[model samples]
Target: MQRLVLLMLFLFCFGSLHAQQTEPKKYLVYLSDKNNTPYTIQQPAQFLSEKAIARRQRQQISVTTRDLPVNPAYVQTIKGTGVEVWYTSRWFNAVVVRGTAEQLAQVNALSFVKNSRSLNRISSPSATNGTLAVKNSSGTSSEALNTMLAPGDYGLAYHQANMLGATELHDAGFHGEGMTIAVLDAGFPGVNTIPAFAHLYQNNQVIGTFDFVTRTENVYGANAHGTSVLSTMAAYLPGKMIGTAYKANYLLLRTEDAPTEHNIEEVNWLIAAEYADSAGADVINSSLGYTVFDAPSVSYSYEQMDGNTTIVARAADFAAATGILVVTSAGNDGNKTWKYISSPADADSVLTVGAVDSLGVVASFSSRGPTADGRIKPDVVALGANAYVLNSAGNLVKSNGTSFSGPIMAGFATTLWQANLSKTNYEIIQLIHRLGSKASAPDNTLGYGIPNYSRIVTGLPTLGAEEGVALVNPVTGNDLIILLADNWRIQLTELQIIDATGKLILKKMLQPDQERQTIDLQALALQKGVYLCRFISGNQIATIRFVKL
Candidate 1:
């Protein structure tokens, strides 16, 4: 009986030891305070770059506790407890760590530790079977490389820029110069060596890079999604292809782990955003979105996409509120069961972009949404389907996803902001929304539609005289009245009304004194979409937008 009892005790001890060895889990340890931190709000220069501080000063934003770094002593104490610190978020006052249950318990016992929660169970890469792996290529096609390197006109790319009136913006000398953009994505494997990015390298436009996934500066060794995404904004192989913001500087940050998806990536994104804010990024383009995760237990539901629930969504809002223009993709899940946008894309203040085709039609695969809170999401649309992008193999490829669309819009937005340096980020966002194709009539499929940069630029306060044209009941059933401001009447030479696709639907040569005329579109059988009315009076031109219901 004594021998049997001894054998049972040995088996129980062995079982406990085995469980302890194999069951280590990842956790997010929330800290109660930033007390005794060396940084302070008054010493903003220490935490924020000169440009970042300049932006804050221009916008009248104040430095607060959120800007302070996490206490090093707390991190050190957690590390001393044998818990490996994965990442720390100053925004949330928390640190992510990996350790056994016993170690986590010890961390929880510390006075500074507020609370801790299990993020998810860590599994081997093989165990995941690419469940949540980022869909991007790591290898380049040789044929594509040769074809892409050959000089050609801005072939397929012109359509994208033209659709949003970005070509005109570029012509006006607003090509995102003197702007800084931060791209957070899964990775950027060949960005350093790509021929298309040579200008960015030569001009020192690639200002910074970091891998939050691995906690290293080696961000150019992972997946190619970021490389393709960055190409939409920074690639500058003139004649062949040019990005929307090729002249803008960039900071590349890898927040998504292509091999896995978990809540931790959201935390990583928040941390990276804070880093970008400190680094003085004028625009942040994040092609990464989160909805589902490898661990089913921790996956977010559609209800959580209310623009405030998810950690990443909150972070995106914070980034926007802090004077940075945040742009995120509206996820590629239109055909899936969860046919709606994911977090960060659902963020209210951030510009959530949806995917459209070269013909300016919403892509079937583009995510749609009135966010869980019933706010019209995807603030604008951009050409993402068959979007031209430079791959890791130095080849221009046609990529399809809102991932490309967000960066394209972001680059253009930076250019717009560059032109209007006096405008605050919020004002810029509002202007972009107000200038969209369907601003008067927004829906979940493509909220606000594509932006009209040409119209926006023409309407800027710095621009000469404001166009006195206004549409009374812009969304009219059949009759549309073009009201002219009661200013000195100028002889109307030619009036042209064009559709969203720039197709001239009606052209009329007006009499010299014909002012405030009403056009009856019932005769022409107009469809329900946005249209532009161009008025030519001598050398002066004024364009007004109206909607046909």
Candidate 2:
């Protein structure tokens, strides 16, 4: 009798479970048109902030229909089906809702409903406990004695900052003041409580915080990746550490979910980006990238890295179109099998950053790229390997990834932009590319290489006097030959080659009208490393860097 009762109980539970499984799942309903919208492009002030409007006015970008909100009547009709509307996307003219099959059938019957797709459901890894682990150190402790360094003292981070000429910008009083940056990343665990960020809080530089993953205002919980990333740009601990844009205002946004990887996170990012745009953010620094996902079926192949295909990439471009500069990481996938940059980084207008060491050499793990459309990726690079960052505990730590590099570059870019308010975003991006170390010879490894802010700000040296110059057979066992442009018989006053440390190793005083010159580096017994060749023709000077095998 007892065994029979147990069997009957199991049967009843199974029946109930099966019945519940038959219920409808949530779907993302894409709308066809926004014909019934109450808002209009002429009244952009309703949706866009004053700063946002000013940006558009300064850039001469006009408001369009896309800037208007989605049709409210269409949304109300969908909600009438007894389904709870979760979120709405103005960019896609869509809404996400949870409803039963019968309710969804009613929604599909509406003339405005274009199509609906089921939202992907995936289980979170137990190790993560539905939260991404904080990689940086975090906690409260007594302030160390060395916490009060001079304002100009960058401590261990000096090399990274100096590499991009950030120190020079800071010295020029362009420390990103009057500019606002939106940092979009996984999480920022202890930003409000950490002493390293005490200045940011004290000065009220942290203008706002939002968690898109949980749809809440509390972004101070999920993980510390953002905290570390932010430190690269905003940390102001004297003597101990200093960020690139220590004086800049910031908006902290949690867009990436550390515990789970899904297509939804991309949507979350898009939402956060729109928020940043509406909030009048001048620049956005996103260290997040997407290629693979927890659900293998939804993963993006290498070929799909084209700038226009991915949703996030399209959104990034849209963000740029709004007169906001978007800076993103190039991904740390160089040493892996899928050794190409991730989406959004592939977006043509976005400033994608790669990683390099203190010596200005490309990091082995920095993602390489020649976009699907054949454009050189990683518009620029910065010090990312063993990059200095502050943990939540208000302690300095060394971390490695393109994640840190992107913000470092972004911070510098902010200062640069602050210095030149008249320049458009497109013009600024082009200037940065032209100012990179390898701007003229960019490749897949380190596109355009590192940038020098001081050089860009002071005006790049003019090369008008000469047509072209090249180091024939750059890497070889024989003598290296310097080739000048055809019909260019300019007098060569002096030629010098220096080592990586700026030590002059070879010097030659050339005769007048010697257009072509040869330097036998083997006779100098130079070491195998990178060197810069400096050529002087009357008042014009040009420098070219080459590596020795």
| Residue pairs that clash (backbone atoms under 3 angstroms), model 2 | 138-392, 138-393, 139-393
Per-model TM-score, in order, reads 0.76, 0.75
**Alpha-carbon RMSD, each predicted model:** 10.7, 12.3
State the weakest 10-residue window (summed lDDT) of model 1: 126-135
- lDDT per residue, candidate 1, 148-264, as tens digits? 222244556777776777665565455776678989998998888888887666666777777776767778888899999998887776676777777787888988888878877
Model 2 weakest 10-residue run by lDDT: 131-140
Top of the candidates by TM-score: 1
lDDT (Cα) of model 1? 0.78
| Model 1 RMSD, rounded to 1 decimal | 10.7
Q: Which residue pairs clash in candidate 1?
A: none
Give Cα-based local distance difference scores for all models. 0.78, 0.77
